[model samples]
Target: MIYQIYPRSFQDSGDDGVGDLRGITARLPYVASLGVGAVWLSPIFTSPMRDFGYDVADYCDIDPLFGTLDDFDALVAEAHRLGLKVMLDYVPNHTSSDHAWFRESLTGKESGKRDWYVWRDPAQDGGVPNNWKSFFGGPAWTLDEASGQYYLHQFLPSQPDLNWRNPAVRAAMFDVLRFWMRRGVDGFRVDVIWLLAEDEDFRDEPVNPDWKPGDVEHASLDHIHTQDQPETHEYIREMRRVLDEFDDRMMVGEIYLPVVKLLPYAGTAEEPMVHLPFNFHLILQGWTAELVRGFADSYDAECRLRHSWPNWVLGNHDQHRFKSRLGADQYRVAQTLLLTLRGTPTVYYGDEIGMTDVDVPADRLVDPAALQQPDSPEAGRDPERTPMQWDATANAGFAPGGATPWLPLADDYPAVNVAAQDGDPASDLNYFRALTRLRAEYPALVGGAYRSLETPGADVFAYERMPEHGGGERVVVLLNFGGEAADVAGLAGGDTLLSSLGDRPERGAALRPHEARILRG
Candidate 1:
C-alpha cells in the first residue's frame, strides 16, 4: 500500500497550526506500523502558498513553514529507517511567481531569464494572445506591465507556466530532480504531467458547441493544442534518465486523461517513461457494478498490454474524501477494491481512519480559488486540508497546545479520532491494518493477474486475483456498493479469507450493505 501524506494536514509539531516535516517525522512510526510500503508526500517545497505548495517557489529548498532542508533530510532518514519509501511531489509544469526564474523573467525582456517562462505579445484586440482559459476560471494569460507581454498560467495567475521548450529550463528542472534524488528521496509524484507543453504557434482553440452551463469552463474548449503535446514524452524521457541514476527510484505521473490517452504516457514495457501513470477512472466513475467492472477491466488490460505498472487512488486532498462521496458504510467496500486491485494502491492520509471533509465557511477559507469566487461551489480545498485527528484531546491532539488550526477542524473528530478507535478491533483503522497485512502476506493480492468475476448482483463487484507461480493462489474479492444485502453466489467451497465488516464463513453468504469479502480459492 502507498500512503499519501498531505504535509499541511498530517500533524503540527510546533503548535504553529500548520503541519511540518518535523511533525511528519514524529508520526513515522505510526505510518510505518500500518504496513504501507511507501509514503507519497504532497509538495512541501518553498512556495508563496497561492495554490498551497503546488506553486513551487524554490524546488531545491524546503519551505520555512514546513521546516528546513535539514528537517527534510531527517524525515527521509527516519522514513527509510522505518522501511517506508519516501516520494516527493514534483511540480514541473509551473512555478510560483516568486520563484527566481519567474522573478528574473518578469524584470524585463532584456533579462537573460526572459525565455524561461512562456510569454506572448498582446493580440491586435489587446486581449490575451490566445483563447486559453485557466483551470481556475479566468484567462490563462496574465499581463505583465513591466514587460508589455502576457505570461501564461494554466492554473492560477500566481503560478506562471514554465517554458519546457527552452533547453536551459529543462536542464534546470532536471538539476532540481537530481538534487532531491541525491538527498535520498525514493521517487516523485509528478503533478500535472500532461500540461508540460503548449501549442508553439499560440493558436486559439476552437470553442465546443456542445458546451453547456455547469461544466468546467475550461472544458468548454476542445483543448486541441493547449496541453498534452507530443513533446511531453521527450521531457519525460529526460526525467527518467535522471531517476535512472538512483536504484529503485520510481516515477508516478498525474495524467488526467482517458485510459487510451494515458497508455502512451507510461511508454513501452522495455523503456517506460513513467513507472506508473495513475488510474483515476474509479474516482471519476459513479459507484456501480457495471461501471466499476468496465473501468477496472479496461485499465488492467491497458496496463498489461503495455507492460507498464498500474497505480490506483480513491481519495486525495483535491477531491472529497471517499467516505463522504461513497457514504460511511461504503468506505469499506471501496477500501477492499483499492487493496485487492492489481496495481499499487494509494491511500490518502486520514482515509484509513475514515476522515470526512469538514465544512469551511467563506470567510474562514484559506484557498485562493474559494476567495476568488465565493459564490461558486468550489469552496476550494479548505475542507479536505483540515488537520488530522490523532486523538480526542484538545485540537484533536494535532498540536500540543489548543491552538486554532490552519484549516477548520473536523467536528466529529472527538468520536472518530485514531486514539478512540485504535483499541477497537472493528474500527476502520484496525480494518485498514488488516487489509494492509493481507496485501503483504499474499503475493496474489499485490502482484497478481486480475480478472473480473461475473457475480449475480447489480451492487456486487467481484474480481479474482491469481498468483503467477508456486501454487498460484487465487483470491476473490467482492464489494457491495448499494445499501442492501447482496447474495454472492458461485463461491461456496472457497475459504473466506478476509472481510471488511467481520469474519464470515463461506456459503451462500449475504453481504451487508457496503460490505466487502475476500475469499481464498
Candidate 2:
C-alpha cells in the first residue's frame, strides 16, 4: 500500500503548529508499522506558501518551515531503515513568483531570463492576451509592470507557469529530478502532468456552455489545445530515464483526465512514461456498483491491451475524504475495493483513522484558491489540509504544547483519533492494518490480474483477483454500497479469508449494508 503523507499536516514536533521533516522522521515507524510499502510526501521545498507548497521557490533545498536539508536527509534515512520507500511530490510545471528564475524573468524586458516563463504581449484591443482562466478563478495571465508583459499562471498568480518549450528550462527541471534521485529518494508523484504545455499561438479558448461556478474554473472551456499536449509524453520519457538510473524507483503522475484519455500517459509497456498515471475514476465518478464496475472493466481492459500497469486511488488531499464522501459504513466497502483492486493503491493520510474534512472558516483559510473566492463554495482545500489527529489531547496531539493547529482539527477527532482506535480490532485503523497485511501476504491481491464477478444486487460490487498461475490463490472481494443487505450468491464455496464485518454468516448468505468481504478459493 502507498500511503500519502501531507508533511505540513502529519505531525508538528516543534509545537510550531506546522508539521516538518523531523516530525515525519519521528513518525516513520508508525507508518512502517501500519504495513505501507511507501509514503508519498507532498512538496516540502522552499515556497512562499501562497498555494501552500505547490508554488516552489527552490527545488534543491527544504523550506525552513519544514526543517532543513539535514532534517530531510534524516527522514530519508530513517524511512529507508524502516523499509518504507519515499516518493516526493515533483512540481515541475510552475514555480513560486519568488523563485530565482521567475524573479530574474520579472526583472525587466532586457533581462537575460525574460523568456524563462510564458510571457505574452497585450492584444491589439488592449485586452488580456487570451481567454484562458486560472484554476483559482479570473484570467490566467497577470501583468507585471516591471517586465511590461503578462505572465501565464494556470493556477495562482504567485505560481507562474514555466516555459517548458525553452531548452534551458527543461534541462533545469531535469536537473531538479536528478537532485532528488541523488538524495536516495525512491520516486516522485509528478503533479499536474497534464498542464505541462499549451498552444504555441496565443488563441482564445471557446466558451464552455456547460460552465458552472462551483465546478473547476479552469474546465470552463475544452482544454483541447491548452493541456494534455503531445509534448508532455516526451518530457515524461526524459523523467523516466532519470528514474531508470535507480532500480525499483517509480514515477506516478497526477493525470485528472477520464480513463480513455489516461492511457497515453502510461505509454506502451515497451516505452513507459510514468510507472502509473494515477487512476482517479473512483474519486471522480459516482460510487454506485454499476459505475464502479464499468470504470474498473474499462480501465482493466485498457491496461491489458496496452500492457501498462494499473493504479487506484479513492481519496487524496484535493477531494473530500472517502469517509465524508461515502459515510462510515460505505467507507469500509470502499476501502475493501481499494485494497483488493489490481494495481498499487494509494491511501491518504488519516484515512485509516476515518478522518473527515473539517469546515474551515474564511478567516482561517490558507489555500490561495479558497482565499481568492472565500465566500463561494470554493472554500479551497483548507478542509482536507487540516492536521492529522493522533489522540484526543488538545490539538489532537499533533503538536507538543497543544497550540492552535495550522488548520482546524476535526470535530469528531476525540472519538476518531488514532490513539482511540489503535488497539480496537473493530476500528477502521485496525481494519486498514489487517487489509495491508493481507495484501502483503498474498501476491494475488497486490500484483494480480483483476476480473469482475457478476452479483445479483446492483448495490453489490464483486470482483476476483487471480495470480499468474491458476494454481495461485484466487480472492473474491464483495462490497455492498447501498443501505439494504446484499446476497452474494456467486461465491458460495470460497472460505472467508478477510472481511470488514468480522465473521461470515454462512455460505450463500446475505451481507449487511456497506459490508465488505474477501473470500479465498
Candidate 3:
C-alpha cells in the first residue's frame, strides 16, 4: 500500500505552522508502523505557493517552505532506512510562471526559450484563441503585453502550460527525473499526465450541453482538444521509458478519465506506460455496494484483459475525506474495501484515524478554487487538506509550540486523533492497523486474482481473493453497506479473522449494520 502525504499539512518540525520535509522524516516510523510499503509526497519542489506546490518554480530544488535539498536527501535516506519507498508528486504539465524557463520565454518572441511554454497569437476577433477555459476560471489564455502573445494555463494564470511537443522541454523534464532517481527516489505520482499534450491545430472544444451556470467554468465545454489527446499517450510512453531507466522505479498517472480511456495509460505489455493509471472510480462513484462492486469487478476485468496491474484509491488531497462522505458508521467498511481490493491501494493521510473535512469559514478560505467560484456545488478542497491530527494537544500536535497551522484542525481532533485511537483496540486507527496486518500476512491479497462473489442482497458487497497457484489460502471479504443487519450465508464455515467492529462475530452470526469482515477457510 502507498500512503500519500501532503507535506505542508503532514507535520511541522520547525514550529513554523507548516509541515516540512524534516517533519515527515520524523514521522517515518509512525508511517512504517501502519504497514504501508511506500510514501507518496505531494510536491515539495520549489514553487511560488500559487496553487501550493503544484505550480513549481524550480523542478530540481526543494521549496524553502518545506526545507532545503539536503533535508530532502535526509528524508529519502530515512524513508529508505525504514523500508518505505519515496514517490514524489511530478507536476510535468505546467511550471510556475516564475519558473526561469517561463520567465525567459516571457522576455521576448526572439528569446532562445521562447517556445518553452505554449504561446499563441490572439484570435482574429481579439478573443481567446480557442473555447478553452482555465480550471480556475476565465479563459485559459493569458496575454503578455510585452510579447503581444497569449500563453495557455489550464489551471491558474500563474501556472503556465509547458510545450511538451518541444523536444528540449521533454529532455529537460527527463533530466529532472534522472536527478531525483539518482538521489534514490523510487517512483512518481504524475500530475495531470494527460495534459502533457494538446491539439496541435488548436481547435475549439465542443460545448458541453449538460453544463449550466454556477458550475465551474472549465466544465462549460468538452475538453476534447485540451485533454486525453492521442499525442498524450506517446508522451506517457516517453515518461515510461524514463522510469524504465531506473530499476524497480514506477509511475502512476493521475488521469481523470474513465476506465476505457484510463486503460491505455497502462500501455501494452511489451512497452508499458505508467505502472498504474490511478483508478479513481472508487472516489468518484456514489457510495453503494452495487455501484462499488460493479466498478471493482469491471476494473479488475479490464486490467486483466490488458495484462496490466490494477490499483484503487479511497481519498486524496483534492477530494473530500471519505469519512465525511461515507459517514462514521461506514468508516471500517471503506477501510476494509481499500485494503482488500484486487490491486495496489493508496491510503490518504489521516483517513486511518477517521478524519473528516474541517470546516473553513470564508475568513479563513485560502484555496484558489473556493475563492474563484464561491457558489459552486463543491466549494473547495481546503477542508480536506487540513493538518494531520496526531494527538489532543494544541493544534492537534500538528504544529508544536502553540503555532497555528496553515489550515484549521478538525473540531473533533481531541477524540479523533491517532494518539486517542492508537490505544483503543476498537478505534479506527487500530482497525486500519489490523487491516494492513491482514494484507501483509495473506499472500492471497498480494498477487491473487479478484473474484466478485454473489451476495444475498444488494446491500452487501462480497468478494474473494483466490490464491495465485490455486492451492493456497483464499481470502473472502464481505461488506454490509446498508443501515440494517445482513445475514450473509455460507460464511459460517470460514474462520472469522478480523471484523470492522473489533469483535469477531460468532460463527454464522448476522453482520451488524455497515460491518465488514475478513474470513479464511
Candidate 4:
C-alpha cells in the first residue's frame, strides 16, 4: 500500500506552524505501523506557494518551509530503516516563474534559456495563441509584458509550462530526478505526465459540447492541442529509462486519460514507460457499485493485456474526501473496495480515520485556484487538505502548543483521530489497519487474481481473490452500499475473518447498513 502525504498539512515540527521533514521523520513509526509499503509525498520542493509546491522553484533542494537538505536526508534514512520506500512528486510540466531558469528565459528572446519554456507571439488580434484553456481557469497563455510574448501555463500564471522540445531543458530535468534518486528517493510520482508535450502547431481546441453550468470552465473546451499529445510518450520513455537505472524502483504517472490512452504508459514489464499509471476512474465513477466494479474490471483486463501492474486511489489532495463523496456510512465499505481490488492500493493520509471534507470558510481560503474562481468547487483543495487528525490536542497534535496550523483543523478532530482509534477495534482506523495487515499476510488478497462473485442485491459489490498458485483460503469481500443491512443468506457461509461491523453471528452473517466484510472459506 502507498500513502500520499501532503507536506504542508501532515505534521508540524517547528514554530513556523507548517509540516516539516522532521515532522514526517517523527511520524515514520506511525506510517510503518499502518502497514504501508511506501509513501508518495506531494510536491515538497522549493516553491513560491502559488500552486503550492507544484510550482517548483528549485527541483534539487528542499524548500525552506519544509526544512533543509539535511532534514530530508534524515527522513529518508529513517524511512529506509523502517523498511519503507520513499517516493517524491516530480512536476515536469511547469515551474514557478520565479525559478531561475524561467527568470533567465524572461531576460530576452535571444537568451540560451529562452526556448526552455513554451512562449509564442500573440495572435493578430492581440489574443492568446489559441483557444486553449488552463486547467485551473482562464486561457492557458500568460502575457509576458517584458518579452512581448505569451507563455503557456496549463495551471496558474505563476507556473509556466516547460518546453520539453529543448534538449537542454530535458537534460536538466532528468538531472533533477537523478539528484533525488541519489538522495535515496526510491521512486517518483510524476505530476501531469501527459501534459509534457503539446501539439507542435499552435491551434484552437474544439469547443466541448458537453459543458454544463457547474463544471469547471476548462471543461468547456477539449484539450486537443494542449494535452496527451503523441510526443509525451517519448518523454515518458525517457523518464522510465532513468528509473530503470535503480534496482526495484518504480514510477507512477499522473495521467488522467481514458484506459486506452493510459495503458500505453505502462509498457511491457520488460520495458515500461511508467510502472503504474494512476487509476482515478474509481473516484470519477462516483459511489455506484456497478459503475465502480465495471471500471475496475475493464482496467484490470486492459492492464493484463499490456502486461503491467495496476494501482488504485480513492482520494487525493486535489479531490473531495472519499467519505464526503461516498457518504459517511460507506467509509469502511470504500476502504474494502480499494484494498481488495487486485492492484497496489493507495490510501490518502487520514483516510483511515474516516475523515470527511471540512468546508474552508472564504476568509481562510489559501488555494490560488479557489481565489481565482470563487464559485468552482474544484478550486479549493484546502477542504480535504486540513491538518492530520493525530489526537485531541489543541491543534489536533499537528502542531505544538500555541502554534496554529497553516490550514484550519477539522471540527471532528476531537472525536476522530489516530490516537483515539488506533487501539479501538471498532474504529475505522483499526479496520484499515486490519485490512492492510491482511493484505500483507494473505497471498489471496495481495497478488491474487480477482474474480467477481454474484451478490443478492444491487446495493452490494462482491468479489473473490484467488491465490495465484491456488489452494489458499479464497478470500471473498462483500461490501454493502445500501442503507439497509444485507443478509448473508445469499452469500456463501464462511468463517468471519474481518467485518466493518464490530459484531456478527458466527454463521449467516448479515452485514449491517453500509458494512464491509472479508470472509475466507
Candidate 5:
C-alpha cells in the first residue's frame, strides 16, 4: 500500500500554486485509482526552499519548484504506466546550505570539500560543540563566520549535517540512489534514516530523565549523541547495498525508533536493511483500543522476533490529522487500523478522504518548525502540510483561481473533497475505495499472520489475518475504539467483509459505535 505524496501539496501543474512533476503526472490517474502499490514522492530534489524540500540543493537536478528533468521523466513515465510505483523523498540526512556540496564545504579550512560538512572547533566555552539541540530550535551548532568553524545543523540552519563518515558522502548518496533507480524509482522513503550516523566521539547527549516543563527543545536531550549510531547500522547496510542494485528496488527507512530500535532497520536477515523500518508506532501512540492492542501485540511480537517485515503508518507529512487526531468518529477507526495491519501500509495524502488539520493562521505560517517554535505544541507543520483536497473549486482544487496556496484550504474543503468523496458511497472517499478493494481481494490481507484476537473488553481491538503458509480465508479485524457499544462475541463463523459504518453483521457480531468490522473466517 504505500501512498505518501506531499510534493508541494500534491497537484498543481503550472497553474502554479506549487505542486509539480506535471502535477504528479496529472495525478497519475488519481494515483492509479487508489489501490496503491507505491507512490511516496515528498521532495522533488534541487531545493533551497529551506526546509520545504527538506533542504536538498540538487542531488541530480529537478526542482524548478518541482518540474523539469523532463518533468521527472514524465513522472516516471506516468508512474510506470499506471500500475504505479514511484517513491522518492530520499533526503539522506541533510545537504543544501545551498549545496554545491554545501557550497564546496563553505570554501575555507583548505577546502577539499572541507571534510564535506559537520565541521567543529568552537567548544572550550566559546559555545556549541555539543549540547546539541536544533531539531528546529536553538543550537545544533552553526557559527561558521568566515570558516572559524561550527556547522552541524540537525534540522535547519539551512540544513548542513552530512558527512556520513564521508566516503565521499557515501559515494554521493549511493549516486542519489542510482539516479532514482535509473529513473524508474520503485522505492525509497529514507529522509532522516536515523540521521545517517552521528556521535563519532562528539558526545554530550544524556539529559532527558523524562524532560517535562512543556517539552520540545529536541525533547531536552537524551538523543544519545544525535540518534541511533553504531555507524547507523553500517549506513543502513550501505543503503541496503544500494537498493540491492536495482531490480524491484525497496528502501523505506524514516525511522523514529522503538520497536526495539525499529527492528535493526530490518537488517541481519543475512544483512538486509530498510525494506521497511518505518513503523512509527501508529504515529507515536495513544489512540486507545487498549493502546492499539498493546501496540499491535508488541509490534507483531517484535516483527516475528526479527525476521522483520512489518510496517504501518497512519498519517504523515509529520503529525496531527489522524482525522485531526482521532475525531470525525475515529476516521473509520483509523482507516480500519491502517488497512488491517500486519505489515506494509503508509497511506497519507489527504488520508483516504477524511483530511483535517488546516488551521495555520498568524498570517499563513509557513513552517520552519512553525517559524522556529511559534509557541511549540510540537512546532507547527503548517497544519499538516495543507493542499491536495482536489475538488470544491478555488484553491481547494489546490491551485490556479489566482494561485496562492502554499498552504491553506481546509475549511472542510467543501464537504471534504476528492470530488465530494467520489460521489459518496458512504464517503471517506468511498470508504477508501472499499478499503483498497478490501486490500486487493484479500490473500488474508496480502500476506497475513498477525494474531491478537480475544477482545471482549478494553474497547475492542481484535485481530486475526492468518494465511502466511496455510489455506486462505481467515480475516477477523473488529476495531471499535470506544464510543461505547462493542460486543464482538468472538465469532468463529465468517462473512461480514468490511464495515466501519457500512455494516452487514450477523453470526455473533455487535460493534456499532465507533465500528470497524472485516471478518472472513
Candidate 6:
C-alpha cells in the first residue's frame, strides 16, 4: 500500500501552523508502521499558494512553509532507513505565473523564452483564442497585453500551461525530474500527464451534447482538444525513458480518462510509459457491490492484457474522503475491498483513522474552488484536506496549543485521532494495520491474480486471489455493502484471516452490515 501525505495538513514540527518536511520526517516511523511500501507526498514545492502548491514557482525548492531541501534530504534518509520508499508529486502541465521561466517568457514577444508557454493571438472578435473554458470557471485564455497575445491556462489564470511541444520546455522539465531523483526520491506521481499535450492545430473542442446549464462551466465543452490528445503518447513515452534511466524508479500518471483511453497511458508491450496510470474507479465508481466488482474485474483484465500493473485509489486531496462519500457504514467494507483487490492500493492521509469530511465554515473557507462557487454542492476539497488527527491533544497535535492550523482541525478529532484508534483493537486504524500486514505476508493477496466470485446477494461482493499457477495458499475477500447481514454462498473454506467487525468468522461467513472479511486456505 502507498500513503498520500498532503504536507500542509500532515504535521507541524515548527508550530508555524503549517506542516513541513521536518514534520514529515518526524512522522516517518508512524507511516512505516502502517506497512505501506511508499509514501507519496503531495506537492510541497515553492509556490504562491494560488491553487495551493499546484501552482509551482520553483520545481526544485521546498516551500519555506514546508521546510528546506536539507530537511527533505533528512526525510528521505529516515524513510529509507525505515525501509520505505519516497515519492514526490510532480506537476508538469502548468507553472506559476511567478516562475522565473514564465516571468521571462511574458517579458515580450521577442524574448528568448517567449515560446516556452502556449501563447496565441486573439481571435478576430478580440476574445479568448477559442471557446475553451478554464476548469476554475472562466475563459481558458488570459490576455497578456504586453506581448499582444493570450496565454492558455487550463485551470487558474495564474497557472499558465507550459508548451511541452517546445523542445526547450521539455528539457527543462526533464532536469527538474533529475533534481529530485538525485535527492533520493524513488518515484514521481505526475500530475495531469495527459494534459501535457494538446491538439497541435489548436482546434476548438466540440460542445458536449449532454451538458446542462447547471454543470461546471468547463464541462460545457467536450474538451476534445484540451485533453487526452493523441500526441500525449509520445510525451508519456519520453517521460518513461527519463524515469527508466534510474534503477527501480517509478512513474505514475494522474489520468481521468475512460479505461479504453487510459490504456495508452500504460503504453504498449514494446513502448512502456507510466508504471501506473492511477486507476481511480474506486473513487468514481458507484458505491455498490456489482458496480465495484465490475470496476475491479474490468480494470484488472485490461491491465493484464497490456502486461501493466494496476493501482487503486479510494480518495485523494482533490476528491471527497471515501468514508464521507460512501457513508460511515460502508467505510470498513471499502477498506477491505481496496486492500484485497489486486494491484497497488493508495491510502489517503487520515483514512487509516476513519476520518470523515469536515465542514469548512463559510468564514474560514480557504480553498479557491470553494470560494469561487460558495453555493455549489461540491464546492471545494477543503473538507478532505483537513489536518491529520495524530493525537487527542490540542489542535489534534498538528499545531501548537495557541497556533491555528492552515486548515481547521476536524470536529471529531478528539475521538478519532490516531492515538485513540491505535489503542483500540476494533478501530479502523487497527483493522487497516491487520489488512496491510496480511497483504505483505501473502503473495496471493499481493501479486497473485484476481477473479470475482459470485455471491448469493447483490450487496455482497466476493472475490478470490490465488497464485497464477495454482498450489500454495489463496485468499478469499468478501465485502457486504447492504445494511443487513449477508450469508454469502460459495465462499471458499478457509480460516478467517481478518474481519472488519472484529469477529473471525469461518467459511461461508454471515457478515454484519457493511462488514468485510479475508479468509486464507
Q: In terms of TM-score, which candidate is stronger, 4 or 5?
A: 4
Report the C-alpha lDDT of model 3 over 1-521, residue by residue, as the tens digit.
89999999999998889999999999999999999999999999999897999999999999999999999999999999999999999999999999999989988999988898999999999877888888888899999988789999999999999999999999999999999999999999999998888899999999999998888888999999999998888888888899898899999899999999999999997878999998888888999999999888888899989988899898998899998998888888998999998899999999989999988988888999889887784859899999999999999999987788989889999899989998898888888899888888888887898898887778999899988788878988999999988877666458799998778787778878999988885
Per-residue lDDT tens digits for candidate 6, residues 70-109, read: 9999999999999999999999999999999999998899
Question: At residue 397, what lDDT does model 1 achieve?
Answer: 88
Pick by lDDT: which candidate is best? 3
List the candidate 3 regions with Cα displacement exceeding 4 Å. 377-379
Tens-place lDDT per residue, model 2, 83-109, is: 999999999999999999988887788
Against the reference, the lDDT scores of all candidates come to: 0.87, 0.86, 0.91, 0.87, 0.82, 0.88
Instruction: Give the per-residue lDDT digits (tens) of candidate 1, residues 45-121.
Output: 99988898999999999999999999999999999999999999999999999998888898899889999999999
lDDT of 6 at 395: 94
Go through the candidates in order and give the clash count of each: 0, 0, 0, 0, 0, 0
Per-prediction TM-score to the true structure, in the order listed: 0.97, 0.97, 0.99, 0.98, 0.36, 0.98
> Which ten contiguous residues of candidate 4 have the minimum total lDDT?
502-511
Supply the TM-score for candidate 3: 0.99
List model 5 lDDT by residue over 209-291, tens digit each. Answer: 88776567888888877888888899789888888887888888887877888788788878888888888778777888888
Weakest 10 consecutive residues of candidate 3 by summed lDDT? 486-495
RMSD of each: 1.4, 1.4, 1.0, 1.3, 20.3, 1.2
